[model samples]
Target: MASDQPRIDFSGGAVGYRFRRSGERGHPLVRAAGIKRDHMPSIVDATAGLGRDAFLLASAGAMVTLIERSTEVHALLKDALARAAMESPELAEVVGRMTLVHGDARYLLPELKPDVVIVDPMHPPRRNTALVKKEMRQLSSIVGADEDAAELMRIALATARERVVLKWPLRAAPLLEAPKPSHQYAGKTVRYEVFVTALKPHVK
Candidate 1:
């Protein structure tokens, strides 16, 4: 029998997840990269932590797919999305455009062909524990770090048809430097590295 805990959904406004003004500036790297709300490629948010970036991408018109391995986080995100769907018409549309999958990104990403695969793995929280936001702490606790992010990037590069976008802090080194990026967005502390790759050819 499953635990009798009340599950949280990230579909609607169930978790109070909102795309307020600050969210536009949520990740400096994304904004600095000139990633507009209207120009987005088919995206697979592999790390779908809290689904913020995924929601933003969908709102920006990208066909976004989110993958989460944690049942608790997935349930919370689903509930929040469901609640947001009922309350905000615009958010509802964005949520409608998103597809959530409960599984590991490595195994699942290879099966699909997306223009861009977006990865934002969980990193260390600020040392001032009190200063850390509630959601940030919650996310850290749930997702932890993808110590094998290098491998994830390798698989993402193999799967993506066009490019793989890696969102990381400016201080950290690029993921293995495997796929040399054609472009980069350097923000205050975070950066978005776009690793371009040719789409697989079809042999008709």
Candidate 2:
């Protein structure tokens, strides 16, 4: 059943266009990730759905570990990364910074001490289904919503050395109430809530 799912491709087509366009400094996701050319943070993407956010961080120079729990989604992501790596020198370099791990981040985060942990759990189903992308719809049909996202945030808070960033719909309530974010970056459709740990000394 999983094999019947569509393969993820980033090398060309609409996804490719978004990939290239996202590399710019002005892209909302990039800015929300707090990426900078001079000081890229080592990041752990706890909910690496399609690897878009992780790839953006790597393209900006951060060493990124992408943790995907779904076997089907992980396979697609792996295949996509392998293809992108062989497509061009620049792409290869970006792919080099990304590491894919198949497992639950809640279990893995304790062992990883990244500068930042990013959590972009699935959003609640939209009333207008057409507003959601086809690829995302497919993903939702397979993996379902991450209902325990609040618990994931708790684990991330304990694991991250510097900060934990949670991506959510612009108008949706946060995953949890306590441990409020130090600040947030808002875009038209999404918002990044940043919880500062301020733990041991680490690169921003």
| Highest TM-score scorer | 2
What's model 2's overall lDDT?
0.83
Task: State in Å the error of residue 140, model 2.
Answer: 1.2
Q: Clashes per prediction?
A: 22, 0
> lDDT tens digits, residues 1-204, model 2?
754465566677655676677544666666666677777878999999888788777877789999999998998899999999999898899899999999999999999978799999989754444524666788887789898899999999998877899998888887788989888988777888998886655645
Stretches of candidate 2 exceeding 4 Å from the true structure: 1-7, 18-22, 127-131, 200-204
Find the number of clashing residue pairs for candidate 1.
Answer: 22
lDDT for model 1, please: 0.71
The best candidate by lDDT is 2
How close to the true structure is residue 164 of candidate 1, measured as C-alpha lDDT? 79
Q: Give the Å shift of residue 116 in candidate 2.
A: 0.6
Q: Model 2 residue 142 lDDT?
A: 77
